[model samples]
Target: MTIRTRCGAWLATLLLLASSASLQANTPDDQLIVGMNMNNLLTLDPAAMTGNEVVGMVVNLYDGLVELDPQQLTHVRPALAESWDISPDNSTLTFRLRDGVRFHSGNALTSADALWSMRRVLHLNLAQASVWKSYGFSKANVDQAIVAPDARTLVIRLPKPNDPHLVLYSLAALGSMVVLDSKTVQAHAVNNDWGNRWLTTHAAGSGPFRLDGWQAKDVLTMSRAPDYWRGAAKMQRVVFRHLQESQTLRLMMEKGDLDIASNMAIPDVRALRDDPDLSIDSVQRGTIYYLAMSMKDAHFANPKVREALRYLVDYQGINKTLMAGYGVLHQRPIQSGMPATLPDPGYRLDIARARALLAEAGYPDGFDTTLRVLADQPFLNVAIAIQSTLMQAGIRARIITGTGNQIYGAMRDRQFGLLVGRGGSGVEPHPHSSLRSLVYNPDNADSARLTNFQGWRTSFYDAQLNRMIDQALTERDAAKQQQAYFAIQQRYDQLIPALMPISQMVDSVVVNNRVQAYQPHPSATTFLRDVWKTPESLAGGTP
Candidate 1:
């Protein structure tokens, strides 16, 4: 039978078995299945796909040079490389490789391996620029990466002084700097490309888990790697089954079939909160939901028109009614708590102001436009509310809803005039990546490539962005970084490319109490390596 059919049958069997077992008290040794409403997984190649599903998988399967502590924000800890040294000039960095680490392919991870991997990532030109953008390496700095005499040491020479965050970006986050086994890749080259068909289904990392099997749009099964650089995973196997329907996911969670679940709909989230049998872990994440306007489109080209649309958003109302007070009203594009950038309260609702701005922009009689929305109920509700608000100012808005990828694709291609979508500054949040990916040209060639839908580019904005990046990298003084951040924020405020509504949205995961040490990361990605089934629970005791 097909994998999807097998998974479906497996789930049905589990449900049936669990129902019968529930006649008596349940035990924790049962499978800890997790449910999700994710529909955006395309590839497992870290350098190829930037969707959350791939990210979720990468967090579990791979290790970076550095990683953020799951419980804290902005703290960095070593992962692949045990330690490193930064040169006095701030241009060159040397890393001390961890000994005895082996890739899933059984090849020893040497300094040469690190160098080869870095070279591949630097040259591969994946669509996700955020991976390497922080390293002060652009198309210009690609040649700066150098290897030392011994294969155990790798060095990255920057054009100028670099921000420490650059290191975090390359080693952490969804950037393309993931190290791979070059020999294995060459030997198993499907189309002579590491990121081609073979790598898409197979994994060859030094991580704790190895890809055993994967069924597209259905289930992904990973088993513990015996030779992982760290220790082996406590659990022998992990299976990711695609349960796109929220109700099905909730039902599974209630039936004790799931160990973890994520991306629950807001109402279902509320319902789960009240269930005494389940424990829900919620965090206000960096993911922001907003309306992306096409600057190239004539209807939204005018600054006043953009301002009018921004003014009509009832952020407070949406937070109360739709989101159930779950998310915060986000203002600036680069989220709060970053080193640089001034936070603005953003545009508030003022129907009079919106009307006046529309009139001033020569749309006194209003205009007809389409607002493309995602298929999700919450996003659709927000779009409908926006449509109604626009109508108050004589603007006729047609609400269009489609699957997440379909709507997102339309927005990226600039096929839609306006789109309701979600984006973020990212885990290792930075302004350069956010600005370039969404508002400017995305430098990568993969799915994460931020297509500039508006087709808006200006030398003035470009120069300012470059200056801000230079200052952030070169300036060691706190005041100077803050000053540069303020200047960039001011420029972005005036530019006003996207209409941002909610800054940080709450993402909740329901985990069984038997699952010990299930800490959530600030970036909203879970680390399954740190999780284990409690001893008492494993011994057939109730959690």
Candidate 2:
């Protein structure tokens, strides 16, 4: 590992530099090879998908009604739906489907297929279901909610008014509203599985690219869709090799073996800032990295203990030195771009205050606890910084590092004490977008199994928070909505639910200088259709 890397435990990550040989063809000028950190890819079925890696890949193979701009989340543009109209009450929407759009399976895109795809989400009750269920969509009423007025017209009728922007935002989100070749999926269905299992490996959508083949822990390859709905992609082929080592990715970029390194370690990313042959792309993503204290844990069940632990976090020390330029200091669940975002309380490490709060909560001396963290840079490094700072207040946090699934799975199962995890999709730049996940969970029902809501995983329930989130989302009056958000923040700060904001993330990528028009999406979405390469990089020459 390079100097100043957060953790020394995983320095062995450098050894892969010699082992990871180039996987791309030397003269494949029309190809874009990406190096991705593919760890928790669970499924490809749009209805049953959850992980970001799988959704990002499948999104290229599928078409939704609308999609967020690749450069920002400020607007949603038409995709499969050429135009749409919303009812004045904000409960009904009618969409006009684009003509001549063809799925990879050679089926024509139709409103019926879009309706079926949506019903599949409700029937399967996957992660996307929370977005709908939260809006009163249920299994019994899902079919009723969706209607096909004609082959090219689709209508969705909501039982109650909702934020039209948020509803459209959900459609643009990962696996939220994907249109499938319904006939093909139904033909492949086994035991009425809706092709959920078959789709885990095969794909059926109308996007710029279609799946050629995929292997877990190996590589995933795609070929440009022929006569794609939008147009043929600039690159004829795209390959994502699953390599998690920072040194190997850097070596590949140096040798011109890889066209783009999709992700890299923070230390290596910072080191490449001055490299002439490379381009650094980064953006503040719609996510928050934080330390979660499970309410199930007896010690953390005390609200004062949770608040005390928050003050113990040295946010400035971590963001400036350890986290450095990769992240920024943020305190609230609402991300930077969203409306009604308040200033950070700016709480720094206060050992004296922490001790006082702990005493007031009946723990005169600080308590011992475990802080499960991902075994990687930034996360482990941040965990270490927090541990050292907590020790000043006599709070001992035993660090446990593991893969993301292992650590986050503990949070989902409510089997953890404390974990360093990231939460909130922030799909819409709305206050409720983050609040719904961070603290709005009202009941830990089976439906709450949606990992999008981390509060459910931690058994953090607040009836008032839930009501406030709903009210704020539907409130059309700007000032009243802002008031609702501000009041919600006050209550959340008081109750000390699940998580403590560590930092606002800035996702980075190291790409060859020849890679052009490569804009990073706010959600870390990789839409390579708009990306192209110059003559130099295409000819396997130096950038």
TM-score of every candidate = 0.87, 0.92
Model 1: per-residue Cα lDDT over 1-543, one tens digit each: 564774566566555545754663333342334566546777777667666667767767666666767666556677777888888766677777777788877788777766666665555566554346544456556655556557667777765566656555546665355667778776776554654466777676777777666667776766667866677677665667689877877877776667787877767766787777678887766566777776657878788898888888887777678866346666766666566646666567799999999999999989998899987767888888888888999889898888866887776565677777776544555554444333443232334433532223211124555556556556767687667667766776776655554545677778766777778766645677756776443454433
Candidate 1: residue 26 Cα off by (Å):
6.4
- Say which candidate scores most in lDDT: 2
Query: lDDT value for candidate 2?
Result: 0.79
lDDT of the candidates, in the order given:
0.66, 0.79
lDDT of 1: 0.66
Highest TM-score among the candidates is held by which one? 2
